[model samples]
Target: MYIEPSYIFLVVPAILLTMYAQSKVNTTFNKYLRVASISGYTGAEAARAILHSAGIYDVQVEMIPGQLTDHYDPRSKTLRLSSTVYNSHSIAAIGVAAHEVGHAIQHNKGYMFLTIRNTIVPVVNIGSQMAMPLIVLGLIFSSFLVNLGILLFSGIVLFQLITLPVEFNASRRAISILENEGFLAANEIGPAKKVLSAAALTYVASAAVAIANLLHLITVFGGRRDD
Candidate 1:
């Protein structure tokens, strides 16, 4: 029931690191958006071309209202882009659109990691929301509950681990597609890669922080139960 100073100290650095990583990603993405122009096609047009070239006719590219909210929905078979990406002619926009299309390509080609990530999506979603509460409750109540919390929290961590590959692979696919399909010039490649790489790091930071916090939690609570 008592808060551990050690755990607090450990989490403080993780919180700061994650925030800094997120800020860098946003700053880099915006910087590239301003400097690197998309040669001709808009992000939506480029995404469609990429999808059509891959013989993916069923996927739809639609504009949504937001900043950097682009994503591919496997369930709906839709590639959703924020207004900036959907309308802008910028390297960052194309890069992000291509990244989402990369997910569609993965789905079509049956990428193993992507498939596994999709399969665990619902379980991870529910587990993430419930894990901390269950762990705290278990700490206050019973050893059995605490162990159950550990198992559940472990699932969340596993999901974060699985997500790393899925995200990295998508960025790799985006870069490859941009190069092969002539969406970006040689100079544009640098900025595009930087944007995608920055975005990917945010995921890495999230996973790292999650695992660290979970370990801190277990170290404190589990040690208390032993005594």
Candidate 2:
């Protein structure tokens, strides 16, 4: 099966858009975080406060070295924050920290999407790593292998689609906590929303690219079967 150049064209824009959205969100979040006052609370403190308020005392908030690498690890029940957010007394820092804490909340609440995502995590990891190689090799060899590749790549697309709501819900919970808990003021909500919204777009672009690539692969390989 011949790979279509059109698929490459389709994915190029999505790749660029995802990169641009990521950079924009990082820049915007950092800029606002640097300037927004947090009423004397640091990011770590804010995260702890949020977790405590949510009755999640077992989750540990740890400082990790890196920029914008913060995430919640459910396995270890650790909320890892980058150095800047871990210690900063800024709105962006609080917002980001709370966002990660939101995941812990989801875990505690038994959120269905989170559960589903966790269940598929291993499959997505393996499928994503293997799909492209399988597809390319199959295309170079035989139609049967090509069909298998497409099926594997379809799994990747499904995983990306499943990821969308999980991320968006986390952001929504973060924003709500910031507002209800008074971590962010009215003036600060706009910037926080921008940061989170921009961040969400990266996921959207990723899903779109995955779907487009899968479609392209199917078009090429499926056509061969028909012929």
Candidate 3:
């Protein structure tokens, strides 16, 4: 019963949620990407302005390649923005840039959740990389290894759960900063909110996927303990 087909059944909900989240994010971003902010600032300028306004000077903003591939590297204290976001003056671009900067700001502020998430990065990385192999080998060889693999994989689930708040808070901070600083007009905030909200749902969907995977392991492997 602990086969790929069984696992598929278990993860179907998460897979569906992930698909919906992706579609929503794409639709929202495309809809808002055409609308320019009244301030006429590019995404890089908006990110720089937000960082300066927050009294955060250490985090450097750099243009990175690819679409919607923006992220903040806390270890390097750098904010990497995709070309579309770094150069475009679209409201969606600014909103996304601002959201990434919010992560830099979080780093500066020593946000507790962010701190915890960063602390576990190494473990999660290793776990994600090794979990499948270890789990398969355990299934073929020893029950102990199966439990070990399952335990390691749970780190990924925990990481995803912690990430939900980190992402949501960053988006919230981004909009608040944009609105309060007059970077986004009153009417402009709606589209920005929609984009951020859609993006946040992706994180939720990711967590769901992780949880589903974890549950499938427990359902399948947990039975091995009795045998």
TM for every model, in the order presented, reads 0.93, 0.91, 0.95
Give the winner by TM-score: 1 or 3.
3
Q: Each candidate: what lDDT?
A: 0.86, 0.84, 0.92
Angstrom error at residue 84, model 1? 1.3
Better of 1 and 3 by lDDT: 3
Cα RMSD, each candidate = 2.1, 2.4, 1.8
Tens-digit lDDT track for model 2 on 10-67?
Answer: 7777778788888888888878776856466789999999999999999999999997
Clashing pairs in 2: none
Give me candidate 3's TM-score against the actual structure.
0.95
Best candidate per lDDT, number?
A: 3
Global CA lDDT computed for model 2: 0.84
lDDT of 1 by residue, 1-227 (tens): 97678667777777887898899889988897776464777889999999999899999999999888889999999999999889888899999999999999999999999899899888888888887788778777777677777777878888889989999999999999999879998789889999999889888888888787778867776544533
Badly placed stretches (over 4 Å) of model 1 are 1-5, 36-38, 223-227
Instruction: Report the error of model 1 at residue 104, Å.
Output: 0.8
Residue-level error in angstroms, candidate 1, position 82: 1.0
**Model 3, position 200: C-alpha lDDT score:** 95
Q: Per-residue lDDT tens digits of candidate 3, residues 1-227?
A: 35576477869979999999999999999888898899898999999999999999888899999888999999999999999899999999999999999899899999989999999999999999988888888888888878888999999999999999899999999999999999999999999999999999999999999999999889877657524
